[model samples]
Target chain A: MHLAVDISLRQGGFTLNASIDCWSSALGVFGPSGSGKSTLIRVIAGLAKPDSGYLELDGDVLFDSENRIWVPPHLRGIGVVFQDARLFPHWSTEKNLRAGMTLETTGMFSFEHIVKLLELQPLLKRSVNDLSGGEKQRVALGRALLAHPRLLLMDEPVSGLDAKLKEQILPFLARVHRELHLPCILVSHDLPDILRLTDRLVLVRDGMVCGQNTLEGLVTQRGAFDMMRRSGLMSFVSLEVDGEPVRAGVRPDEIMLANRPVEGLSARYRKPGVIVRLIDHGPTILCLIDTDEERLMADITPDAVRELGLKEGSPVWCFFKAGAVHSFD
Target chain B: MKSISPAEWTALLLSAKVAFGAVAAVTLPGVLLGWLLARKNFYGKVLVESLVYAPLVMPPVVTGYLLLVLCGRNGPVGGWLGRTFGWQLIFTWQGAALASAVMALPLMVRSVRLAVELVDRRLEEAASVLGYSPWRIFLNITLPLARSGIFAGLLLAFARSLGEFGATITFAGNIQGVTQTLPLAIYSALQMPGGEAAAARLSVLSLLLSLMALGFSEWLARRAKTGRSTHAPCR
Candidate 1:
């Protein structure tokens, strides 16, 4: 499937002009909050009309202001999973899923298949209000899949969820993208969530499509790296782990500190580095460690800093486990 | 307590029929108007809203006079109906139902409009993305979600119609066994000598009927509020 969008919309003070052509099965739209990521998805889903431009999906003209052609959302065959999981409160989970399935679309994904895919057998009889946040999102995904949409738009499906719930729901989202082969444009501010879903990224900033490339390619670009850094994303590195070069990322919080090299530990990597700077990060202190090849930030509690006598130019060992590092690309 | 006479029984039955007819007459138009007011933004929205609520604030006698001017035999709508369908509403039971409907309309519309307003617009947008047509979305989402309000509106209208007095007396006239509903019968009973016992009996019956209608309305609203199955099953 292919989608070509070149649209511009002006809403009060925000003007969004985005142009993207994507053919991947799943594309990630990564940006900070208030970056118009959701607006871009809304326009693609036919929920909003752009001021000027054309949108084509699989050679079908979904919208073309010059041609005066605009297809209503219902006719656009695009299903959207909103951030809030807007389920029909009055309908049972089964009914909400069935509400989107037409007779002709049933052949695409059978009811039994969706029920099995999303593990919705137990939730079928429950009302929407009875389901938990993760359950509701699964039901919403099933409902969207049942519609036989040519493309799916997901707007921060897991942002509202806590860390544990995010981990629980991310696998299902990836499974859906893989099993259904549903082309999706997932908008999210979280980098790990985007990386876990799709490697191809569309970076959006200030209502513009800043860059579109694979994660590795975009990370090398100075503009994209700066944007990611500003958004609090940790830097990634190509590390030789077990004789294979893997692209790995270590979060600031996951990096432990040691005054000297201590053997017989569970952590896989331990590198001695000099403390370049120490910055206060609210309750925790962020120590900028200058390793031989790269600078890594380690979050240490204020108590640890005082007890360890940590200061700039102090020698320290940064410890992180291989399991804690997320490998992408 | 004096036993209800045949004339009083006729008045009671006629009152029920007129109230039922009024509720039936106002339901469709009332819901349509309520939805329009809740969802649409037209040029004369404020004017239309004010006109709809005029009957509630204006004296019943003024509403009756306005109905008379618009629907009397010599009036435009009444003349058109008489010529086209041979239907005359003046000085008849149908006219009393119409008068009651007009007086109860504001309550019905208000309940329905509030209910419609409570529905989340995002749900409607989600429905559109699910490939539901506009009419289907309204039918499956908006209408069902607002059902409690619609039902409350119906009961309110019915109760108001049952207790309607001034508009019915002025527009349809108090004719025995025809337009003389419960309230009109009470009025007539209190006017004559030695009619105090009859008036008391009719008042008791009216009170019982109104109580039953209101009790049912409260029960329905409560059920609608708590009927959803919220407890999850054993995992």
Candidate 2:
């Protein structure tokens, strides 16, 4: 599906100027907490109208300032899962899940099928008031799907959840898209949220679309890398294990940088490699090493890297204790 | 004094009927206006708010005078009704009920509006996205969520209607077994010689009715304050 949106919206003190022309089933809008990411989702769902521009989804004009055409939210056929899971208090879990169902909406997203897909049988009769945060979001997703909307808009669906609850909900979200093939826009601040679902990223910062490209493509650019890194206070990271029966994990900060291989040290697992990239994060810096076997990321102080004269393409040795690398099945 | 004179019973029954009719008459308008005041941001909203409060703030006698001029026998509205439908509101129980309803409207609207405002607009937005229209959203979501406040308002209005005097006397006129509700009955009894005992007994009856309605209204209001606000699913 092709969605072309060129709009300018001002809400109170914040003004958002965003434009996107993309053809992707699942899209991710990545930004910080106050970066107007959710506002973009709201505008797409027809919840908020932009000041001047047009939004054409699949060649259908949802909004057009020049022609004076604007579709109301109910007629937009775009379902949204709110961050708070705004379930009806008077409704039971079953009622909430079936809120969007009607005579015409039966086949592609059926009530019985959704109940089974979300494992909502045990929760159907229960009051929405009694459901957990994760359960509420699941019911919300089911409710949105049962409406048979043409597009789905999710605003921080799992960002509010704790790690364990987030883990529990993310797989369900992934399955919903994989099985149903519903075109969706997932808006979130965290990288994992975008990576788990779609590679197409629209990086929003301070109410502007700073970059729109694939994850690898955007990160290679200097400005996109700095904005994304500072937004979440997390280093751009990826993991790959090569040539071993064991799966090992180690904190990037623990992998200290050294000029040469130390013959006798308390730490184990010394590997010499060339620094491919160095991302500065204020006090500490991240060094991407391309080892003989694989590429590994290590975190070290700027002083350490500066003292070792380590720049891009400079050969370096990385050290970490054997106890630091935890093995997982 | 020892027994409620057949006349006193007439007065009690008439008052209950008038109060019930008053409550029924105001329920629809009360809810509609209340929801409007709470939800809609429009031009001249303050004018509407003042109009709703007029009956409560202005002397009931002046309001009755206005109603009498509008709906009196030769008055335009009353003449139209009399000519078209052969209906008469002047010096009738229906006029008494109408007067009572007007007097009770502010209380009902106040409660309904407060409760409606407490309902989360986010939920209604969610409903709209789910394809429910504005009317369906109000009926299914807003009204039900605000049920407790509406009930409390109904009781308060009922209590207010039971004690209506100035408007009913001015427009409906106090007549024995017809427009003479509790307060009017007590007043009528006191105007006669050696009627102190009858007046005292009927006054006590009026007091009991008011206390009961007030107690119920207070109970509902307390429950409304303490129960079912935002159920944090996250908890």
Residues B27-145 of candidate 1: C-alpha lDDT, one tens digit per residue: 99899999999999999999999999999999999999988988999899999999999999989999999999999999999999999999999999999999988888888888888
Clashing pairs in 1: none
TM-score of 1: 0.84
**TM-scores of chain B alone in all candidate structures, in the order given:** 0.94, 0.90
Question: lDDT of candidate 1 vs native?
Answer: 0.88
lDDT of 2 by residue, B1-235 (tens): 4888899989988998999999999999999999999999999999999988899999999889988998999989999999999999988889999999999999999999999999999999999899888898898788988888899889988999999999999999999888999999988889999889999999988988888778877887676555554332121
Candidate 2 deviant stretches above 4 angstroms = A231-329, B211-235
RMSD of each: 7.8, 5.3
DockQ score for candidate 2: 0.32
